[model samples]
Each structure stands twice: as C-alpha cells, then as structure tokens.
Target: MQDIAREAGVSSKTVSRVSNGSDSVRPATRDMVLAVMDRLGYRPNFAARALKRGRFKAIGVAMFDIVATGNLLTLEGITKAASDLDYAVTITMMGKGQQRSLAAVVERMKNLPVDGVIVILEQMLPDVGTFVPPAGMEVLLVTSAQSTTMSTIDEDQYGCSTMVTNYFLDRGHRTVHFVSGPEESLDSHFREQGWIDALARRGVVAPPVIRGDWSADSGFNAGLELAHVKDCTAIYAANDNEAYGVMQGLAAAGKRVPDDVSVIGVDDVLRNLIPRLTLTSVKMNFGAVGRRAFRMVARAIEDPQRSRPTRELIPGVLVERSSVRDLTR
Candidate 1:
C-alpha cells in the first residue's frame, strides 16, 4: 500500500480507498492507484483481509437449476449486484436427493467461502421442512418455495397470474383457461391458486387447469387439447416457452390467435419469438428478485442480529402485444 501510494503520489488512504473499491476517491486518482498496483503486481490478499475483518466478503448461491431463462437472469442480477458491492459470489446446484429437506440441502453450502448463502428454489418439494442454516451463517431464499420457513424474496407469481387472468376477464372474456407449470413447483402452485382466486372474485367458475412441465412441448400438448373446448376463448400459460408452444399448437389445430381464441402468458422473456404472433405477456422481474435477494443477504451479513423480513415479493407488469385481443372494443 505504501509503495503504490508513493508511486501514484497519493496518500496511503487514497490508495486504500481505491484498492477497497471505495468510490470516494476521484476517478483519476483511483485509476492512477490501480495502475501503480498493476505495475507492482500488488494483489490484495483476500484471505488475510477476511481473517482480519472476520468476513469472507463473499456469498454463496445455491440453486436447483440455472438453465431456465428466469433463473439465469436472476443469477446475472445477483452477480452484478455483488460486484457493485465489491463482494464475490460462489455458486452451487442442489442435488435431487437433497430435496428431502431444505436445511439438509443448504448445509451443503456450508463449506463454501461465503459470508452468507442465497438458496434459489427450483424444484423444492412442497413438503420440504424449514431451513435452519448452520449457526452463525446468514441465509436467504429466493424464488418460489412456499414450504420453507426461511425468509424469501420471491417474484410475484400469484400476482402475475392473477393480473393476467383479470386482464382477460376485464376484456370481456367470460372465463379463462390456464396452462400451469408442474405441480411440484411452488411457482406453479401459487400461480394456479391466483388464477382460481381471480375467477372466483368475478363469480366465474375456474376451469380445470392444463398442467405443463414448464416446457413449450407440454404447452403444445395442452394447446392441442384446449382446441376442442367450446368456451375456452382465452388462455394464460405459466411461462413464455409454454405459451409459445401453445400458440403453435393452436395454429396447428387451425385456431387463429386472438380471433378464434386469444392467449396471454407470463415471463415475457420470449415475447420476441414468433414475431408474427407477438404474445401479450406479463413481464417477470427475476433480475430484480436476484438483486434484491443479494442485497438482503448482504445486509444479513452486515448485521446478523438485525431483524429480517419474512418475505418480499417483487411484482411484474403486463406487456401488451398482438396475441391478446381487446374483445370489449
């Protein structure tokens, strides 16, 4: 630090600030200090720093799968947020056998060099019990896993589904059919509950749900079946992949979108595809969920004794496009 400070002609405090990623130093000063450090091959010893501060300045992210688009976006948000705070991130995937218990699964992350952990639920069993992290370890849950007693930061699955259903109903569609994610998924559970609740609010009977595995193929299969239902004029799929598949199936069955039937879905992640169809979908902010989850976990790390919120729901919005028809007009 002294050598770099002298080389950069800045006080040791200025060098320290730049090295610690503090923004208080001017850009020019920070740059000069960084250049000096690079020339001197001076890399801060993270191990020593962690020992001195009693914190790793790193976080662990545990997930079932990151291949899914929403999960992938959430991870990106978390990593970016961690970077901004000058913290490092370590990631691990939960094993299927570990699904027996949330705490057991989380215990796997204890060996990781992170100050805290963020468990991202994907296929968390509905019956999985409460998660109690190892003593002195802070943890947060992200996404849908209603079974756990752990604090969670979830995307508004119920609200998104309810909003989409109500949009169809308000547009004069008497009732709406739903294509739901797999039953084991908490996201699917909340979304299905919302769809039914929304219909009941309007005194309309909620139709039987068509279950899908969060895949376009399952959605395509559901679409084929829905084609024959006489009153199934509006459909809300659980996700964009399934929604796109549903549209294709509807097309195959000679059911023109927004004409013979209209369809809307969640996770506008794929709204760009099927350019002609242009799905009117709800936009899920998984990235925001990730950012917020990271921030929440960081706070826990900062003050382990502070109170933590039980849950936080990040709401999404509707992006109207061509797929849904305004029947009232």
Candidate 2:
C-alpha cells in the first residue's frame, strides 16, 4: 500500500478510492494512481473485488456440444448478449459420444468465481436435478432438463404439434398417425400430447403412436409401418430428419406424397428449403430460443435478489408446402 502510494505520489486512501471507483477521488489523482498500479502490474483479486461490489462479473455456459445447430445458435446468442452487457463468459463443452455429466460441470462451476450458469438442453443426457447448484448461485436451464428452482426457457413444442396436427385434421384426413421422438424427451411427450389433444377435440379416437429417437432411421421404420395401414392417410413427424426418412419409405413403397398421403413435420432445417420437393413443416426460430434463454440468465445474474425463477416459452409457425394433399381442394 505504501509502495503504490509513494509511486503514485498519493496517499493510500486515494489509491483505494480510485481502485474502487469511489466518488471522492479527484480526476488527476485517480489517473496517477491508476498509472502506478498498471506499471506495477497490480491486479485486483476478483474475490476481493466481488466482496466489495457484490458481483463476480463472469458467467458460465454449459452446452451438450457445439456441433448441434441449435446449440451453436444458442452459444452465439449467449455470447452476443454477454458482450453487449460487458460481461465475461466461460463456456464448457460436454463430451461427444458420451454426455458430460451435469454434476461434474456444476461442481466445477461451484468451485470457480463465476456468478451463474446457462445449460443447453440435451435429452440423451441424464436429468440435471442430480447436480446441486451452489448456494446463492443462479442456474438457468435452456432446455427441458428438470430443476426445482432454476429458471427455464424452451420452445412451445406442444403448440407446434397441435397446429400441424389440426392442419391435417382440417384437411379431412380420416386419421393422422404420429412419428414421435424418444419417450424420455420432454418435447417429445409434449408434442405427442398435443397430437392426442387435437384428435380428442374432434371426438375421434387417437390412433396408435409410433416412437422414434429423433432420428431419420426411426422415422423410416415408422413410415413403413404406416404404409401397411390402409386407413393411414396423413402423418405428423417429430422433426425434419424423421420427415425425410418417412418420404423415402413412402417412395420405396410406390406411394406418392400429397397424392397418396400427406405429411407434416417440425423444425424447418436448411435442407428442407430445397424446392424440388418441399416438405411442409412447423418453423421454429431457434435463435430466439437461444437469445431468450441467454437474456433470462443475464437478467437473473444482474438481479439475483429481486428476480424470481420463471419458465418462458417460444412459439412456432406452420410452413405450408406440397407435402400435404390439401384435401379441401
């Protein structure tokens, strides 16, 4: 303290005031003290700084992987938001084939000096409830991983499912079969429920539901099963990948799209835009999901005391294409 005071030609109190951004320091005196501290490479300890100001100025992000398009967009959204707010971000990438356990990641963050964490949703990974967050630390769940106290943000999966299913139903289809994702996934269940609800609304008994693991292969298998059902005139797939597989299966079985059977899926992937044979689907602004989650986490970090944990939903829009027969015509 005395050394810095001597170097800056100022008193110890002036150095303290300048370092803490207190109002008492004169402009010239503050500059002199800052210059001396810089020359001496005197960095403030973050822990001590946090104690003085009640903020760590850092946030943690835990994602399943960066390769997935949705996760990548989420990462970008988080980074952009953090940069705009002048906050430092530390991102931890989970494993490739085997998911990195949330327990281990949360433990690591607990020991670090970061203020909060934002976890990207991964259905293959186990529930996040196993990992206990640090006392007073904010944790935001960006996906459907369950947490008793964490703030959560997700797309309106059920709503999307209902919109597409109703569209098919309104077209005068006798029954619409569903190709769903894994049973364990929250989105999958919500979507399936929506399909069931839509059928119930029309006083029609819901048809048997085929489960997929959110992959093209599963959709293909489910499609083959649907082809044999003579009454199956319409199909609703979980995602675009599954929809593509369903198309292949229908073609191999000598059935034409919209002519023989109509189809609808969710997630408007880039490849779905190809004009040759456009697959009608429900479009989701995944980037918005990421941005909303990031903002929620940021807000939670800033107002840890006054903010209450909340769950936010992003809506989806149905994109009409040639995949459906337009039975009304």
Candidate 3:
C-alpha cells in the first residue's frame, strides 16, 4: 500500500480507498493509483485482507456437478452478483461424479475461510437427515427438495409442468404423455407430479411416464416407444435435450412433429444446440435463482441477526415455438 501510494504521489489512505472501491476517491486519483498498481503488478490480497477485517468478504459455492447447464448458469449469476457486491467467491465441487454425505460437506467446509456458502445440489440430497452447516457457517441452498435449516432457491418446477400440460389440454388433446428425467432427481419428480395433478384435474388419466436419465439417448429410446403408442398425440419431455432426442427418434420412425405427435419440453436450451428444430419449451431463469441465492447468503453474512427468507421460487415461462399443435382452432 505504501509503495503504490508513494509511487503514485498519493497517501496510503487514498490507495486504500482505491483498492476497496470506495467512491469517495476522485476519479483521476483512482485512475493514477490503478495505473501504478498495474505497472507494479500489484494485486489486492483479498484473502489476507479478509483475515484482518474479521470477515472474509468472500463466499464459497458448492456444486454437486458443475458440468450441468443449470448449475453453470447459476454460477455465472452468482459470480456476477458477487463481483458487483465487491465480494469474492470460492467454489468446491462436493459431489463430482458420485453421491456424498452432507457430513462430508460440513467437514470439508468447516475450515474454509468464507463467511457463507451457496450450495447447488445437482442431485437429490441423500436420505440423510437434516444438512446442518458447521457452526457459524451460513448456508444458502439451490435445490429442489425442502430444507428447514438452510435457505433454498428453486424454479417453480411444479407450476412449469402444470402450465405445459394445461396448454395441451386446452388445445383439445385428451391427455399429454410424459418423458421424465432421472428417477432420483427431485426436479423431475416435482415436474412429473405437476403433470399428473394437472391431468387429474381435467379427469384425464395420465398414461405411463417414460423414464430418461436426462440424456438424449434415453430420450431417443422414449421417442421410439411413444412412436408406437397408437393414440399418444402430445408429449411433455423432462427437458429440451430429451425433446430433441424424441424428435430425432420420431423422425427416424416416420413420425412427424406437430402433425403426428406434438412435443414440448422444459429448460428451453435446445434451440441453441439444434437450430433447425423449432421446439416449444419452458424458460427457466437459472441465473435469477443464482443471483437470489447470493443475495440471501450475503444478507446472512452482513447482518447475522437478520432473519432471511427461507425459500424463494423463480417462475418459468412458456416459450412458444413450432413444435406443439394447437387443435382448439
């Protein structure tokens, strides 16, 4: 700090203000200090400074699987939010490829020097009881299951499936077939229940739900089977990837989309991957969920006594495209 201040012909306090991003400093002085900093290759030692201030000014993020699109998008939101808030983020992949006990996560994070943690659960929490973070550690969870101790954020998954199913029913389809994601995923289960409940409301019995592991291959198999379901006219896939596979399988089986079997999916991400397929789908605001989670955790950090909202749900919107057939007309 002193070296940079001397080099830039400014006081140590001015350097401190510039480093901390305080708006009190004049723009010219801030620029001069930053230029000097660049010339000297001096970087802010956030961790060291955090230790001195009694607050890390940093948050840890734990993702079960960072490879998942939803998790990655949420992380993007979190990093952007943290940057804007002048905080740092450290991530730990708790469950990389297999299931891990909550106790293990607690143990791993016990000594980590962060004020709080944002956990993104890629799979359902193990049958283990409550997940209690280490003492003095605040946790904000992004997951599908309920938690009493940890704050959680989720998309309105139930509402998402219900809306899509109702769309089909409102279009004069007697029932909508379902292609579900992994059985262990609470997200898939919630969506599947939503579809079932919606169909039940109209006194329409839900046919068997085809199972997919969120893989295009699984969706392809589901498509092949549904191709032979004589009266199955509408399908609600667990996600856009599955829908894409279903479409490919249907095409290979001489079945035409919308004309033969109207299909829809969730997550609305396939359009980027397959530009030619005009698939109707639901849009999940994954980044919003991430930003909200950061805010929730940050609140717990800044004001330890403040009571935070236990749960928040970001809603999904239906993105209309060319895949579904509207028979109501």
Candidate 4:
C-alpha cells in the first residue's frame, strides 16, 4: 500500500479510495493510483473488500450441469450480461439429492462474499422451504417452474403446447396424443395443461398422455404404444430427443411421418444438419431466458430495497417442418 502511495505521489488513504472504486477520487489521482498498483503487482483482496461491504461483487449461479445445449446457451447469456456489467460469476454444480446438494453450496457461499444468487432449476428439486437466503444478499430463481413468489424467467410452455395441439386439431384430426416429460416435472405438467386447453377450446375430447423421462428411448417406447392405436395420428413429444425416438418407432412400425402420423417436438435442436429428417418443432429462445434472469438479478442487486418480485415469460415460435402436416386443408 505504501509503495503504491509513494509511486502515485499520493497518501495511503488516497490510494485506498481508488482501490475501493470510490467515485470521490479525482480522475487523475485514480489513474495514477491504478497505474502504480498495476506496476507494483498490487491486487485488491476481494475477501477483505467483501467484509467491508457485506456483499461480494460476484453472483453465484446454481445449476445441475454446464454442458447441456440449452443450459450452455443460457449460461452464455448470463456470462455475457454479467461481463458487460463488470460483475464476476461463480457457478456451482448440484448433483444427485437436491436438499443436501444445494444446501451445502448455499452454506459455502454464505462463508464467501457473494452479493446474490441465481438458482437455475434444471435438475434442482429443492425441498419445500429449503432455501434460507443470506440476510443482506439478493436471490433470484431462474426456472421453468411455477410459483407465485419466486422470481423466474421461462417460456410459455402452456401456450406453445396448445399451439401445437391446435395445429393437429385444425387439420381435421379428432385427437392429439402427448408424450410428456416426467410427471413430477412442472415444465411437463404445464405443457400437458396447454394441450388440454387446446382440446377443450376446440370441443374435442383430450386423450390420455403417454409418459417419458425426457429421453429418446422413452419416446420410442411411447411411440410404439401409440403406433398400435388406431386413431393416433399426431404426437407432441416434450423435447426434440424424444421426438427423434418417436420417428424411429414410427419407422420401425412401417409408418411414414406426416403420412401415417405427424410428430412435433418442443426444441429445434440441430435441425439444419439433418436435411432428410425434417422435425417440425417449437424454437424457444432459451438464451433470452438467461438474459432476463440476469437482468432481474442485476436489478435486485442495484436496488435491493425497491425491487419487486416478478416473473417474466419468454414465448416460443413454432417452426413448421415436414414432421407435422397441415391437416386442416
């Protein structure tokens, strides 16, 4: 500290102000202090600074994995937004049991200087009332899950599902079958609701939904079952992977897609690479979900007292592909 002060031709107190990012320091003085610190290899100790501010300049993000395509895209948005704001991000991976896994991470963060936390809901099954957030820190829950109080940013799962269902019904199909994600999943549940809503609006009876764990194999199994049914003309799987399975199952049964049955998926995953397999699906802007989550976090961090708890919904666009035929005509 003394060396930097002497090199910058300023007192130690003046050097301290620049190091702490105080706006009161004169521009020339701040520049001189920064230069001296850089030349002297002086690094500000964030831990020490955190103790003074009672908050870390970094935000903690909790998610299951960093590798999933959707998760990775969302992460990119979060990192980009945080970088633009000059904030650091700390990512914690929660595996297996939710109660134990996430609670441990939260405890660890409590020991550090994190200013806020953004909990990504993928693979997160937190126990009821498990999150006891830190007293002076802000918390944001970024998820597709529904709750009245939690701040969330996600797609309109219900609306998009209804759109797909209506697509089939309008085409003169009497019933639409749904290949849903795990029953415990709220995303899957909301999508199912959307399908039912569409059926009700059209005055058609909604058929029973088949279950999948968001896996290709599960979709394949559900497809095999549906293939045997006489009136199963269209299927809306929870995601693209499952839709691929549906295609395989239909092919094995000697049924051609859009001819025997049309398959629609939620995600347009890598659709351009496979020219022959035209998967008509919904294209969700997951990156926008991530961006919105960070924006909410930033707002909460900037003015914790005035920020209101709010939920933001990002809509999805349906991409028409060969997988689904316009049966309305």
Q: Using TM-score, give the best candidate's number.
A: 3
Work out the TM-score per prediction. Answer: 0.87, 0.78, 0.90, 0.87
Candidate 1: clashing residue pairs, number: 0
Clashes, model 2? 0
lDDT of 4 at 73: 83
Candidates sorted on lDDT, descending: 3, 1, 4, 2
TM-score quality measure for candidate 2 = 0.78
Candidate 2: segments with Cα more than 4 A from true spot: 1-52, 93-105, 124-134, 144-148, 271-277
Runs of candidate 4 exceeding 4 Å displacement? 9-14, 22-36, 97-108, 123-134
Q: What are the per-model C-alpha RMSD values against the true structure? A: 3.2, 4.5, 2.3, 2.8
Q: On lDDT, who's better, 1 or 2?
A: 1
Give the alpha carbon lDDT tens digit for every residue of 1-329 in model 2: 67899998888888777766677888888888888999998876768878888877778888765776566776778777777776778887666654467666777777777788887766534546655556667888876434666778877887887788788878888778999887866678888898999888888788888888878888888888888888788999988888878877887787788799888888887453556757988887777886777678778778777767687778888878789987777
Off by over 4 Å in 3: 10-27, 96-99, 127-129
RMSD of 1: 3.2
The 10-residue segment of model 4 with minimum total lDDT is: 123-132
lDDT of 3 by residue, 1-329 (tens): 89999999999999988887779999999999999999999998766767666687888888767888888899999999999898889888874554476666656666787888887866666733466666567887787667777788889888898899999999988889999999978789999999999999999999999999888888899999999999888999999889988988998898999999999989988767775768999999999998888988888888877845497878899999999988877
Stretches of candidate 1 off by over 4 Å are: 1-36, 97-100, 125-129, 144-149
Q: Distance (Å) between predicted and true CA of 184, model 4?
A: 3.2
TM-score of 1: 0.87
Error of 1 at 174 (Å): 2.3
